[model samples]
Target: MTTVRPLSCPHCGGKEFSFPDKGRCRCLACRSEFLLDETPKPSPARPSGGAGPRRLAALCFLLLLLAGLLYALAPAPAPQPASQPARQRAATPAVTYELQQLALAADPTRDGAPLVLRVRGGLGQKGPAGYVADCYDPRTQAWSEETQRLQDAVGKNAREIRFQAMSDGSLFLVLDKSRLFSFDFAARQWVDARPLLERQPRLAGGVVQIEIGYANEGDALRVMTADGTRRYFYPAVDLAPTYDELRRMVADYRHPQAERRHGFTFARKGAGTSGPQQLIRYAFLDNKTGPRLFGGYLEWDGEGQARHVKRHAHIFRQAHLEATDFFTPDRVYYRASVAWADKEDLIISFRPTPHPDAPSLLQSLDPEDGAIRWTLQCNFDGELVKTADGFYLLQGAKLFRISEGRRPLAEPQRLF
Candidate 1:
């Protein structure tokens, strides 16, 4: 008998087998036939208990790494309060304003008296309704309001009203160029001048142009007919000339010479001889390079010759020589609009061309050499009023007192 050994199939690892021949055996589970080998196989070794310590150390390292990741992902803690007190925000600086608004419209007369008018409604639609007048004495800085309401007597049909102050301390109101009223501090009431105006034959039958001037002995209201015939009314004496004066008492005031030169039009002109030097100021406009304003002046000799002509021209965009003209679509022709010279200096006001919405500029220039004395930025265009001590700028519903000093402008003082 041969010695027998336990056998298993190598391909299928089946343990149960059947003997097919003397040297071959067939696996019962896999149905494979193979030669049986009596050789013994070695077994794999099992893990020992010492490996547990290594696994536990690896798990602790993993937990530590996870905690570190979580710590890194978390948000930073709130900042701790400082040992010293916290800093405070800085305070804002105070702003300085330049212009002030008034309740009434103020203008100056030839005799240096300011005429203040208060109109309640629109001048074009409601006329001079609810109107009051005041006479301001610059010498005393006192205001005397008129006693009567002008609208009560004039009525609302007088759509337009113009106030003119005479050299003799009287005020004239021309309503629609058809009706005339005169008042003085003594009269205290408006006197109807239509009767005096009707007395003149030349003004009786036709449409005439009425204007106030210092043509007669004192201030007179002159009425010119369509045919160039003129009549004068002296409110001081209530006198209207009987016959048209062949030779006028005063020659017409001469305007500055305006001539286009060097691609510029002298659109505005002003003449002032009150200063030590006589200057014919002009505002030049050049439409070619956008719109630029050039403030210029011509020094004239007694013989009507130009002694020196100087122009200060610079490039600007959409510069307006006359600020009011920006709103007028028809382009009205004007003789003087921008510049005038007082006893001390040549004053000019114009809209800054570089910035369309910027405030208009008011500048004083030296009468001798045309050097800039000082400059101011005003919101609205104003009329300059010359007085004994200083100048007053009459803007719409606002008054600015300008002193002779080199400083810009002083605080506004309410007149009434």
Candidate 2:
């Protein structure tokens, strides 16, 4: 509705006004009517105080209201929980093989290690006494002679018992009679491996050397005479081999006179490879330098024909075992034969302790250059069988299952 502006009527000059129609206005006092001017009056020139600032303030107020409404209506960002500090990762146990002289001053492996076994079996039980076998039960911290009862009667007469490891986590008890008995840890049973080891070549320390592992049908057994003058290889078999049957299986005729006259032992055949390749080890005792080892790898086909041959030696040069190692203050007092060897590595015994009762060091070396790879203070006296995970160290009558771990070298807890 438009407001009628009062005007002096033309007849009576009245100031009163009224809206008689949509656009006409009437003056009541003078009874006069006229068209109403509905146009808005132009705003007065900005007041002395300036209305421009007032308009701007109103616009700002509206923007603020709109922002507040949006903030309230929109979903709130996750609480974020006051930005909790990042959780630190759990620390891994620190473990290292002590290679430094300072770190090895005190033997940590034996100081308080729980006794797992005590050798009670001996060769005198019948003939020349063999080592007594026992096992350590970590759960009970007690020693038990579980291995002694599992052997065949012949195995009981061996001068000493040896651990022959297989890739499938099976263990072979190699008796002195060139016989083998299998024991499965998972099955907790003994296998009559006597058939597989029938007519085996004699093996002894400081005398004959024998090594056996996986072959196609069963195992590829090897025997080397003390002088390494004669080496015999027996392929996998399906049945117990007769004395004459085994003689024909020996591959001694395939080697050269030089290799036969001296000795060759495999370093690594990558025993993992079930192919036609295998490792041959070479042993030489030069009167001037003492003893040295070499690796000879042979690749052949099903026809028993040679495909490739590689030879490696001088792997222990860094050890200097032939030089001042066993004499000087470097603490290398004694050097022993390899306790473990493969194509790529050689694990040997180094007696560093002057005290006869102290433990010896087990050092792994690179087969290519005899460079020391790692050294662990172990009391096994170069007696052990390796598995994929680590190895079982045989100390006295007890067997300790040692795993490769990162825990710092510290006194073992009284968990035994």
Candidate 3:
């Protein structure tokens, strides 16, 4: 903060002081002035006189004569030896590794062992004790029982149980329409109830399914229902999108006649409810300018609200064709032929397929815009697994890597 201030002269008691660009300031009183510091500058060269020019000409002739005498006395340099041909070495090709369906956990505990995938079968009449915790190990290449039913037998209403590894080396299990349950592997005990799934509204027909969406901020599991409703399940926070907007998306885009189920995406910015949250309907492509809307299909903002903002068209334009079944996270380095798009601003991959009657080939669309990015000859299931180099695509048991820049590798390698 350099500031300018007026200075008063001591002699004449004048208030004026000069601040010059090239020199120091001077006081107007008593005509007192201080000399400014000067920098040293190189002096300009002067023209040479006639005597110097003649001497320089004589030196040049003497130098030429000395060079001729030296050349005449010295033998011509021997011809340089013929250069030998450099040996050509063959290029080593990139080593490709076959991607096996290896089990992966959330945390690193065991050394390259299959993850403990626990699944609850049909509930028996044995009460809570009947619930079984079956462990899937890659060493034995089979499911082993780590612990049997400690409590009463589980009820027969038990369907598929969702299992995910926690950061604390614990397994999270949530039965459909049930509360969240955490199983600690180290302590070998069922701790407090980890609420990861949201409760469903009671209807004439019971809620058929509740699939976990992409992971959002705070590591909350975004839950999707058979209907169009979506709920965010973190530790203690709960957020549901607008009911009317979800219903409209289901009726218009996902499940038109109530026969099919619509998809929903939740992208969170930070942890807990304080963070920015966006709930988007997985349907249509459209842009917005304040109240004015544009593009092919209209969609709600990421927060699942009706805020009229520009739908990201740049990503859409890059996506030539879109697929509903894709991997989470847009950038994948697996040896697979699968890629993801921005599902509600979240990363997910998809592959496009051609129509039965139309001759137009299917192309991968950019998430920024609806424009196509890559053309695919065959249909892809979009099952991508992460590997060391890139993501692994498990298509018909053949593993392939989806290279950088959205290009599919050659043939797939057999994992089995």
Minimum summed lDDT over a 10-residue window in model 3 is located at: 286-295
Cα lDDT of model 1 by residue, 102-131, tens digit: 222223334344444433322333343344
Worst 10 residues of 1 by lDDT: 323-332
lDDT of 3 by residue, 1-416 (tens): 65344345544556676866457657666667643342223355566668888998999999999999999999789899776555534554443221112223322344322233344443432232234444543334555546544234343554445544422244555555344566655443455453233242322233244444332122234454557555443333233333344333322232112222223343333322223333333443221100101123222234323344333463244222132322233321111221343331213332222224433222354444434455544345534433233334445434334433345445343333
Best by lDDT: 1
Models 1 onward score TM values of 0.40, 0.32, 0.32
Q: Which parts of model 2 have CA positions greater than 4 angstroms off?
A: 1-170, 174-180, 194-235, 238-334, 343-346, 351-360, 366-382, 388-391, 400-403, 406-416
Q: In TM-score terms, which candidate is top?
A: 1
lDDT of each: 0.48, 0.41, 0.39
Model 2 C-alpha RMSD to native? 23.3
lDDT of 2: 0.41
* TM-score (C-alpha, index-matched) for candidate 3: 0.32
Instruction: Estimate the TM-score for candidate 1.
Output: 0.40
Please, what are the lDDT tens digits per residue for candidate 2 over residues 116-173? Answer: 3222333244433333344454546654646454333333333444444332234555
Candidate order by decreasing lDDT:
1, 2, 3
